[model samples]
Structures are given as C-alpha cells and as structure tokens.
Target: MTALTLQNAIARTEAGRARAAELAVAMNIAIVDAGGHLLHFSRMDDAELGTVDIAIKKARTAALFRRPSAAIGEDSQPGGPLYNIESTNGGLVSFGGGLPITDEGGRTIGAVGVSGGTVPQDVTVAEACLT
Candidate 1:
C-alpha cells in the first residue's frame, strides 16, 4: 500500500486552509498517516487555541479507524453501539471534521481534520482537501 508523503500532506493542509478561509472561519487543521502519526498541521491566525489538540486527535481518530470521525461520534452517543468508545485509543475524537484519505485503490492512506469552525464548516473544509 502506498503511504502518505510529506508533500501531499502539505498540499492537503493548504487546500483545507483555503477552504476554511472561504468559509470565513479560522481553523486548526491536521493530517495524519494511516498509522495515526501526524504528517502535517496548521493553525490559522485567530483560530481557537483549544482546537489545536482537537484537530490532531480528530485526524488520528479518522486515520486509525478508517472512517469519518462523525460516524464514530454518532455511534458513541448514548444507547449507541459504540457508546463510551471515545474513551479508548488514548482518547479518540468522535466529531465531524475528521475523514480518512483514501487512495485510488480504495485504501485509506491518511486522514485530515479541521477544528475552530462549526462542525459542518469543519467537515466542509476537510472534504475540500480530499477532492
């Protein structure tokens, strides 16, 4: 399987950042390899200071789980199948801004996450980077 490269990570970060700008929201963005290792990150000026770790955690959660973090978030709600799962894996972020990065072969090569915007806006920005 092909791995995510630094160049691609940087490109993706820029793309996400641009989308966040278009949304008129400052953001903290993170890209992580399939192994949940951070490959790139950016904090837009005026982004919420608290969102930095959240962005990284979201990317790691998506990369390690190979699914959008929002799905996990849904499942983790009360009475859901994955209830309390957020406590696992050194704290997985179950939120909308995290998405797996899939390759042409349909393999998840990495993930991207954005924070500091509303959940929908964050998701939109991250999705823009994947396209």
Candidate 2:
C-alpha cells in the first residue's frame, strides 16, 4: 500500500489552515503523516498557544490510531480500558475535530486536526479536508 508523505500532509495542513482562517476561527491546525509524525502545523494570528499543542496531539492521535479522535473520545468513557491503552501509547486525543485521511483503497494515510473553535465548527473544518 502506498504510504502518506510529509508533502501531502503539509499541503493538506496548509489547506486546512487556510480554511480555518477564512472562517474567522482563531485555531491551530495540524497534519500528521501515516507514521504518526508531525508534517505541518499552523496557528492563526490570534490563536492560543495551548490550541497549537492540542491540535498536534489530536492529529497524531488520529494518524497513530487510524481513527477519528472523536472515536477515541467515545472509547475513553467508563468501561473502556482501551482508552487507557490509547493514552499510554501516546498520541490520543479523546475529543472532536480530528479526522483520518484515507486513500482511495480505504487505507488511512494521515490525519488532520483543528482546534480553537466550537465543536461543530472544528468538526466542520476538519471534515472539509477529509472529504
């Protein structure tokens, strides 16, 4: 299977950042390659420092787990020891606004994360690129 490249993640990150800024959401956006390494990231002019770190963690979580961060959030509830495993392994964000990017063959190749906006708005921006 073809693997995700840093270049692709960078492009997607740029697009996601542009989209987030256009929407007037002061957010931090991050994109990670399939290997769960940071590829590109951006913070809006007025975005908070914490948002940047959270966004990166969110992207890494999605890429490393090969699922949306929201899914992790769901699994993190009571009776889900799996959530603990995810966190222990690192790169797990149990929150919304993180999405995995899959190839045509349905293989996840990367992930994008957006923060510093409402849940709906963040999810909307993240989904915009996943599509």
* Leading candidate by TM-score: 1
Regions more than 4 Å wrong, model 1: none
Best-fitting candidate, measured by lDDT?
Answer: 1
TM-score for each of the candidates: 0.97, 0.85
lDDT of 1 at 121: 95
Local distance difference test, each candidate = 0.92, 0.78
Candidate 2 lDDT by residue in tens digits, 1-131: 57767667666766776777778888787888788787777788888777887788888888888888888888687787564654565546778888888999989888888888987778877876665
Query: Residues 1-131, candidate 1, lDDT per residue (tens digit)?
Result: 89989999888888888888888999999999999998899999999999999999999999999999999999999999999999999988998999999999999999998899999999999998897
Native-to-model Cα distance after best TM-score fit, residue 113 in candidate 1, in Å: 0.9
lDDT of 1 at 10: 88
